[model samples]
Target: MSSKRRVASGAVLAALAVAQGVLAAPGAAAEPDTAEAAPARIHEIQGTTRLSPLEGDRVRVDAVVTATRTFGSSRGFWIQDPRPDDDPRTSEGLFVFTGRTTPALTQGDVVTVEGTVAEYYPGDPATTAAQSTTELVKAHWTVTARGARVPEALALGPGTVPDALTASPGGSIEHAPLRPDEYALDFWEAHEGELVSVIDARLVSRSTDYNELYVTTKPQQNPSARGGTVYLGYDRPNTGILKIESLIPFSQRPFPKADTGDTLTGVTSGPVEYDSYGGYTLMASVLGEVKGNGLEREVTRAQLRGELAVATYNVENLSAVDGEEKFAALAEGVVSNLASPDILTLEEIQDDNGPKGAGDGVTSADETLRRFTEAIEAAGGPRYEWRQIDPQDGADGGQPGGNIRMGFLFNPERVRFVDREGVDATTPVAVERDRRGARLSVSPGRIDPQHPAWEDSRKPLVGEFVFKGRTVFVVANHFASKGGDQPVHGRFQPPARTSEQQRVQQATVVRDFVDDLLAVDRRANVVVAGDLNDFPFSPTLRELTRGGTLRSLMDTLPESERYSYVYEGNSQVLDHVLVSRGPRRVSYDVVHINAEFADQASDHDPQIVRFVPR
Candidate 1:
């Protein structure tokens, strides 16, 4: 007889009938010989959130099957005790791994399982350092009954969830369950691997590449004016957010494209587990209806009278390979959305051949810029002129192949480039003053090109332009990226910001140069803009504006409205426009085009500011 038939008779058969909660077979009321023979509760096998105390020990548990995954590397079913334990820290649910074999059981069916408890790590156990999940391995089970009751899912949200996942100074998870009610990491640690639900939660960020959505039950702290959350400071905590992972098992394409402020109703049920990539996530088995509203494309603001408009945009490594479609969309955004600004500071402009040619050490970007300018004109914009200095091969760090650099695009009809002698990739420009005011010695030159801070980074491109008979000195920068910095959700507590030191040095060099320009002419019309790759409150920004010679235009807007980039769920400011004392009462705005949408043309939203030169 098969294992299924052998377990479906005598005492096992009677117990299976009684587990149904409806009918009682003969001799179903008979008790076991001793209390030790009775099955253990599910919570006992899952003592704490981190690890089970009874791992590797043989035990028997009686639980109702809640969910099952029949195909996959980790094929398994979740079983939960109908009657939960008194301690909230202990989870009443446990996963039973059956490998390739399908267990002879159905949802809501009561069964008695005998197995050895083990802690399983998803990835390689040797290298990756993360918490392990408790499971019942090499298990055999007999159906105790059918139609058993399933435990109600515990609702998780604010007040019930903690504020932040890691402690400050050192980003690490607390293991002692201290302040479990106040910290999200602690709160989630207490309820690991338990059946959970999030009802009527609103999406806080767009769906990720892995088809995950971040949602919150209450309004997120430090909410941006454009309907996203902001990272206040290093000390401030961000709590009350949950990651919804893998919406339903075996369902093709579970996640739907959603924007911030969209509502998700219905009882979204799942098992809470620690995901290596996403921190604590609810591997959901069921998702409710997604209501998408309150999201629309933002319109361009009208240009101010007598004020020259200057814009900064990171095109996300645009090259000739981006093809005509992307270039057209980008042109539409520049012409229609940016109102054909007089001067445009651009970053991430690739070499002429894009990534492919960049690998062969080709440095000319003339073809790339020409194609983009043509596209802009075709989209009904001004015939613009461009200027830039190609970096030494492999000196500027970015994607290994794509040699990215900073450049400028100005409407020649609106502004004139003030050219001077002796400007090249290696030569540094200096601030000079005539009877009129401060001007660049070299119209299109680099600032401190040989500075150690710019060793492997894109050198700052300084250009001198005259708008309506007034000279405006513009500095285009693409500072060191935060490539090596540890993720805020990673294992390290207060993840290390390794790239900050280099950015600080870069900012200092630029700040000193700006000071020199101001000293020559305190009222110099200087507009410094591009992807600074740092936050407004970061030490890097403070170093740049230490003497108050330059002020961030973002500071002029409401704190909630100052953002140009979004990562995870935090809307942050990586690009900025800082003006010297000359440009007064500048009107600045972060145009809502990209960063918030999945189909966005670029990863960053362009920023536009208009000011009348003094």
Candidate 2:
């Protein structure tokens, strides 16, 4: 949610206590400066490239403080030069990181300070890669004057930012000179650390728990059906989206609560700064009043009597320790919104003591299922009997100790689960044929669990169920996440999806499973569903739907309505329900329950496909 304005702890420090008069900033202000020079302008310090040419050299600048954070992890002040420069390539504003000193400064306070030019990255390079923020660290300060003339903030609008989201696709643009007129990243880079404004701001996504929200200056740039940005392709990533991190103290004004389609009906002024979350962000000091758009969560119509309603939901690391309120809200979403699916495949089911149980050698999730099913029954929904294969404790790569795995919950009255011989976590589930047609070697088993693609990831849980005397082969999946992927607005122009190939490998594994089932019986009633954490247009999806064996329900909907998850400001698909050609008539929906709301039971929206198996 944050660009992580607060810095790392292993910084150089020759200063005093971290919190003397203000809160300790993210970087514990460690670097000390001994070099001093004549007054230098801000633009000269900010070169055309991402890294400043003057970095590591001590220089002074006379500028007015545009904003101040005397408290919190980013306790420092932002200053911009009043004099205008002809070159649009260099920025006139700068951020002074107050390491240990709580410099008493106010907005519009003129100051001349000497400091070392340093490029700071919020995260460790050994684990995560993040963009660097140019800062004037380790300083000697002098108050030049108070209440000086501050430059008018640059107005950012649809016309100002480039329509092109990037200049290079999957290539580094760090050395590229500023091309402000041609690219969005370049435009923001030219105005880095400078005050900017957005009028009639629309909050595209829900305000995060950290009080951070994404706003768009261009609302018409590939707008989604639900009044949000649409991420159509790797090239067209909705360049209008810009993140906002409030600098205003929470005590002064709590960040306004807002969801998708809500508008901040005035000017939102803030300094443009770079962070790793989603690149350039509006470090908003002035916020507008939020106007409600009356956007509500969507509901999918319940399946007909002849239809077998199957759904997939990621319960976001659900465990027995979760609060009753959370369980009840989730149950309500299923009952009222989803109208209670017949067979639900749940992902991220943790153990009895939540994630901690894995470390404590307690891996059973019987209690977690008990609480969830009871909550569903309490909410006036059907009593769903559950099935799951517990993974090796602490083997899955989710939370440190959370051994999350995929599970199933089926309504006994509506459908019957076929319980055959099962295999452990490392064993595989193979397809076999008998006189009664294709059948699983073991019912409710995992597909190729020992494959390298399943290493440190959840294996695909394949379940066989009978609805109206016909067998339905459903494979529920929670593939490798998109964690290691670079930010869309990152230094790599198109941004690298290092986590993508793993998903592709996982998708290929699942695709082969579906193909094998269809090979035995061409008209196999197979459905592949779950949090396959990638976009609908991604290679992962293409692989899953390859060879015409399985068809993605995502292709059935209009482009505007094909989203199941919202990222930053873009409404995109990260969850999907795919089926074989066996079902002639199929109705599918990416239900809107949690992603668009601020108070969500889960971060993901549960999706369902209704069809009658032939």
Candidate 3:
């Protein structure tokens, strides 16, 4: 057997990794008679079962336990199946299914799971990998009750009550505690294409900034349906500011008949459980039951203020284009939603060349820039004025024609733009290439040689806005890319080529710039705003607040009202307005507007802050 195969086999019998070492709390483990013990040592099994299985066929099995995931009522993990050294199918692996009975098994929990050998034909790796490919390329084995079964352990936060041991179903079952996050990560990847069930799952009340869901394996299903904290979302048509009521969990739920630990089983999909702003939770399954409870009202726009605030939103791929109509509509929407706010910072608005940046048939990058100026002027209350980076054709780590840019618009009647400077910190290519001993190039598009100096340039648009006889230094910037395949998502490219390191370097450059600005102007009432590509706790952002150079506006606000963007159901605070060292002359706040306003238009929300210049 190859070295890799041997390693794979070793993983099957290896002990599970510790999760903060929290063992079964006070008699939480299952009884000795009910538990199944793993074989002292398991046998090795490998090869693709391209053909149908021989009736009653039994095969010895040993493979590395890649991960254990939970969705609905099922718990499962993946194992790399060994194949011939030269076989194109060598990359194949198998998923071992388990029942969802909490003190539920966790990620990296290596148990000897055995079942009848099954065969499944190969299909699109992406599709079949999640389906039943294992049935065709069968390697069936059922684990015996010889492996040590850790006694059932009670959970700390939300306790559980083990139900009566119903008929042991057909197959034997066993379990152990596992790390929640690791379990969620592995489960989503392994069963990403299958069906699953969940029970007694409660909806997490808070909004995930990015609209993503996060669950805590078994933890999310404990106690009763109402006690389990799970984030919820749905697949629907039409985008922009999806209402919280549209999500399934908020509108409906099941009763509390079955407790959290009761075993529920179903086909599994991905993202068994995960962590987020609220906590962790488990995904639901096909056969899962929700105790019928009337609808619950969790989030409502009535919770928002009617005026005087910045509303941050993602203008999905707001590219530099010819028609300023789209920009005009967006400006119109902002004006309608906010109705007030002396200043507004926008992220992802394309403005490649100052206000004249152009692309393809587009005349300039600031098409929206122009539209915004016009729209505000048309609105008539407070005339608008704007400023943006000069897209000097990629002069300073700037995009071609300054395609997608970040800038702000001020209500001239309310405030005035005093002076400003850009914060460009992209390290030069020569410096990076010299450090790595090789030339660096990204697949999406290489840095332009003609615009050499552009690589190290990224400046936060720091504008001095005068309001009520006080000056507020507003630093607006958009951070590095998220690097995914979807254009609606942050920029995506290969790791080495479109490396995060480059983005990190860019962040460091900005941090230094902010620090210097603070040093020179001690009394400056600085407020940093814009879409920072990274999350709040991300290391780069941590540095910005390390020495108290900046204070997060969200930190001073209530939780429910903090988020500025929603991704996949998860509400996150990506767009921010940070304050600097000085008296609080101006207060920062997210307008807390309805997300439906931005679902289809853009991927970001606009953020506004009110300042009474000191």
Candidate 4:
């Protein structure tokens, strides 16, 4: 809590000197001007004694860290003292010893810590009182420290747990997989509703969005299983599950709320769960005293003023080919043909090698998207950032040159590519024509399967965009074929007929994902659009549009202009734009653009949709 807890000493200077000799110029003399300067200010202590001299009451200590050592704690041994004393006797019972310091500390490192001077207390190991300190006990530790180091990591002192239970055998409980009895309370007054820290209590029950926070005075020793009190914490926003770790009362001491400073209150229900659909997170929860910040309010173009514009275009197989001008032409066509929407939803982008393949013939997912981005930027459009899952070359029925994929392109000026959600649907196997169609195995050269799920499947691309002063959700999907074979029904129809089954399944997943999102808040503005590979009369499309009043941009066209890809000799509208609600119907249109391009980059025509929200 004090600014003085950031000072460095001469030991740092000596260390830097030795470091320079080892890391800097070998034969040439080092220049003084090039040397780092010492900080003008020194770290100092800020102390305030509490009326109750308990173990976890944070104090202030302004001293230089001479050494760092890890010792056994109630949980297990971890990096403890940044600087340990040579005479353990003198250092013992100092009350105020350093716990964890971010940016780490080294020998002779100077730092000023403002935290509780913890003292060991006696207790039993069986009861909550014996297990650890109770919420009312005021034996919980509070810490806040700042220092200079290579890589900073938060540290916890012995006082992290109540002194009473910490000394008992099978001591302070490890808070991993949080126990039900170990709950936490966050104080947000200092941050004006921004949660500062928490007081760990016990959990009574759990729900989809919220949980009950209660104080535990004793531990429950299960003779049949590993023993410890149940703790509580969650990560989902909106639906509130208290994040115990996030609320650990480490820094922001002095209690953010004046009334809550020492008072131990209980909120019967609190936010606990956050459901993620597509790329958006829906946080749901119940609060005790504080009311909602209208977080459930829907974000739309009207709320975003005129800064947001909804644009969609179907880019036919934007795949890269080595030594072929078509690859460069394809990239150029995507940037040139499509209207630049603040957030552009693209369809039929090819992933030949991986997700984003090299246009130069090599199968590389990163290369394909990289070229597409470069082409967009080169075409006088805003910098284009995108998200896609690179599949292995020949995985599934991927494009020949690279892994042809579906994705979205956004102008960073309007929206920065924060992160993506969902898993990749692409496989990593080489081209192995097995009897059971094409079986996909993991490819060694493609993206390592060890990464997160989102990187594997290119099915759905999730991204965040800042518009109308609120975050808007964007999801791009390319459903499976509608006429594919349906082995599930024992119906040996054409590949096209069976394709509908996979399409329905994919749509169901999308619908369920969207339903989960709407459950958190009904007003969320979501757009599910792309070359569905299915027609309007199909059952899969009907299922997706059933509950939420889905609006199709293609419906606005004069039926003739709605088709995206022309098959056989028949011209039918396959591409579409589906919104949450069809407002005025007059406010949406599907522009037939690619039909006019003489080069006709790919077989599929790019469909454009413009929507004006009322």
Candidate 5:
């Protein structure tokens, strides 16, 4: 709505916009559907559903330019009808993608445009599917009038969105008639491309490095104690959570950089758009400043000298060559926040050269662990000795050369690692019993590395540790990531969890291994921990803790506090610690140090469990 507003779309939208049209002649890209080809108004083009009824049809329309991107990869302008459309179901605005070419007009400039209506699905095919934004691609326009008043932004508040997440159950809601009063998806669809604003909204999550953040209009929604809309269930995606994408470039007015529980002071206005990252987004023309709520990082109580404290952390692809600051901060979290757990299971420890940065086909993480352990010692923590079996070069799934794998770090002063030879990446750890009862055949060994469940994924690292003269079997895991799962708010209701099958397989392998330990000794001190990468409510967890051989530490916490990760705005658990029947008394914590903060060393929050072995 402002002439000075600049468009700063995300990399996903920017790339998709370039895919809309590259200007190989003005109308060269249009492949009009045989259904129709005629002049249409904004409402007619947008229709009354989630998708445009006239999509894929070439049409002509006249409207005023509301916003424009003169630079960047997504060079496009937003156009909207000044006149009223009485139907509350249809939007009055549309995006005109000009590809690499910048628009020649400013805000309030009326224009007549002809183009093919298209639906632009952001991100690549691999990204979780979500609602798409309707666009006018391969366009040509001419100025009809200048200095016309810009359309006023529609005010959105808590009352604007329906408490319901969607109207259709897991089916394509594209044909469903608009029920803006009953469903949030429909309400957002009704206002698609229309300039909208939310005043003084509460930030639900921390602002990303891109200066983007999610805010909630509903204060009473399923909120976390630390001021976040907890994604309690797949059906309970908070309707009030709105993603604010900065339209004003950082050079002009930077996006508010704040943590969760912060507030967006003043008006935040923008056009409603959809993307893969955050389903419904408000591309802001008017940016809001952040008022800090002072949500601080949490510090767990240090374990007693006699207690065995084990922690699991996914350092987020840490090989991490240029991560001096990151390494220091992570070490500080281990020392100050996590209280320097005796045994730490680190996931995503990349190879020596960082993510895809390695040459000579190196896969070992000697340098990576060396730097991380040194940092921990410098941060007033004990020298942590580490052990891990290196995976075959380029065998793991993460960034190609990253060779990400799970490793263990233990304080020799607090605990002693039981050494066993013949442990390699492919060698599976086995439970062997002799005169001294059950013990590991190979310490620092892998569990079923050659199993199909571990194909292209990090193998579970199994180790033996002795604390207070008691042997403890620790299985550290970094299961397959949730990369391919369809979003909960995707077009398909109850979006399919395609990535879950792999995690389930990995869980079965880990569960069976735990069962093997329990089989050899009925009361073995065993701890299973690491980045499970699945929620507590998932089938993967159900299968992993089957037979009750290992009980998840998350089950020990209150329902609201069972989270170690915050995704979008949902406070949920991905990392977990589970103990066997041998630990008579246990205390577990999902240390809230990183996941909710804007300044984070890792995307995941490390979780620790302390117990006295039998």
Candidate 6:
């Protein structure tokens, strides 16, 4: 079952318990006759890997405090049995919620907690928040003894850890534990809310804003040069990496700024909990210092001979207001990393004023392109000319006043732009037969601007170019963004991708235009390249290549090396370059300068392909 259904089920159990008069109001005194009731062992209260059999029963547990969260939404402390049971399937630890009131308890203090056994979901129960934690709520506590010995933490590493992060098909944790020794989800479920330790773990990714570290006990699989593991395909499971969630409510400024491959040693103790963002996170009580590994930056690819390079880059909402620093970095990426491509299709190029709410109809990107081109020349690269047509005021959807659109940059020394007259933002350009066989009516024009699919989205820009006495038709596209899509690890099992419907329609429009060109001349040199915003395996891309008129170059890449963007822990592809059958592809590569790094100039990694004209 999905996590949402399990939470709903727990809500029902809570209602039943309240109706039976088993649960009392907060701070309410227990039944007067129960003064002689014997305290229950922590393991008996936490019966199995799933729900507690004693849930809703008023029980008293005697144990020693292991960790405490004095503040934050989950103001509570963890108590574990000093002498644990022989069975490894049942945990001996539990979290006692004291609400906003602080309890006078310290680590290693022996205490007896009397409360109603209730399962609680951290945030709102109805939302995407996953599994409910078995917690003791609406209770009272008293110190039985002070400064007692704390329970020894269970050590976790390679052989003891499960191979796969999840066992379910869609990557959701199952409601109940399956084989605890086989899957990570099952093993974590068995030890829910228990104190555990991971020693000498390697940092696989940078710490998040919430001061959480993603570490692995073993070496990362498909390790990239920058220290992150490159997710080759969905065929294999994760490499037993886990997140260390911080309970420190104050500033995490003292936390180290370590890169990938760094080592973190010492005893890192925490109680495991299921979090919405990170699947199973350890709310740490004691975390170790990060030691850097002296990792260096990745270099650029070498330029190939007798090949014309074309690149696609999404300069995340570039405009004049961003100043020179961002532009200079982008120029270096384009020239050094991309090997000074002859034709560069740029996406997310904002208006002159940028995101500064200066209304639409601004229509001037001269200063923006000039600054970028100047930066390229300053970086010891060629001075390139740019071409674009501004969109109608507020017609394109992006950051409100930014008016972001797609455009092109080309080196005049290598290629020449073929310009035609009478084209505007609303004008829909078409292919026509001329003395030069098949050609665009107006070069650098919008494709099917009147189609409903192009509403509030970027329109495909078609441009005609001549390189080495051969005409090449290029289409620059920036499809609708993937907004409002459900997260991969959300409550919904096999989460819905609602944004794909609009992209399917957009793909059809672009494919029809390509078909019109192919009808005029069967073997026309056509190259479509840009930030497609859809994976090569998605249904939207399937529609584009349905008739086999255009083929995605991504198929030529090895399965392990076909990613241009990283989201969560998976490396995926959202940018593409498709070519007709006429051209000969020399090489293609997606540069890994950004995306995996914490200090990234842009969220996407640029892609370049070298091909020879027919």
Q: lDDT by residue for model 6 over 16-62, one digit each (tens)?
A: 22322233222322232233334577777777545677777878776
- If the candidates were sorted by their TM-score against the true structure, best first, what order would they fall in? 2, 5, 1, 6, 3, 4
Sequence-dependent TM-score of model 2: 0.93
**Candidate 2 lDDT over residue span 216-235, tens digit each:** 88988878788788778875
lDDT of 3 by residue, 57-94 (tens): 44333333333443435335544332214332122344
Q: State each model's CA lDDT, in order.
A: 0.76, 0.81, 0.39, 0.36, 0.81, 0.74
Model 4, range 1-614, lDDT digits (tens) per residue?
10011222444434433322232222111111222222211111101111112334333333333222222122100112223233211111121222232223332333333333222222322321211111111111211222423111111111222211111123222222221112121111001111112223222111111221212222231110111121111121111122221121224322121110011233322111111111111111112232211111111222133544555556556554333454555455445544456676666666544334334444445665677777666766667777665544544243444455556677767655544233444332122233422211321112223323223233554444555444445557666543323211010111125456666766676666556445544545556767677777677778778775466666655533445543211235566677664222224444433332223445555544444322
lDDT of candidate 5 over 412-445, digit per residue (tens): 9989999999988888888899776689889989
Per-residue lDDT value at 509 in model 5: 91
Off by over 4 Å in 3: 1-195, 199-314, 319-329, 351-363, 375-381, 394-402, 419-458, 484-500, 558-562, 583-586, 594-600
Clashing pairs for predicted structure model 6, backbone only: none
Ranking by lDDT: 2, 5, 1, 6, 3, 4
Q: What TM-scores do the predictions have?
A: 0.85, 0.93, 0.49, 0.40, 0.90, 0.80
> What's the distance in Å from true for residue 32, model 5?
14
Task: Compute the lDDT for candidate 1.
Answer: 0.76
Alpha carbon lDDT at 472, candidate 4: 49
- In Å, residue 230's CA in model 1 sits off its true spot by 2.7
Candidate 2 Cα errors over 4 Å, as ranges: 1-32, 124-129, 169-171
True lDDT of residue 208, candidate 2 = 83
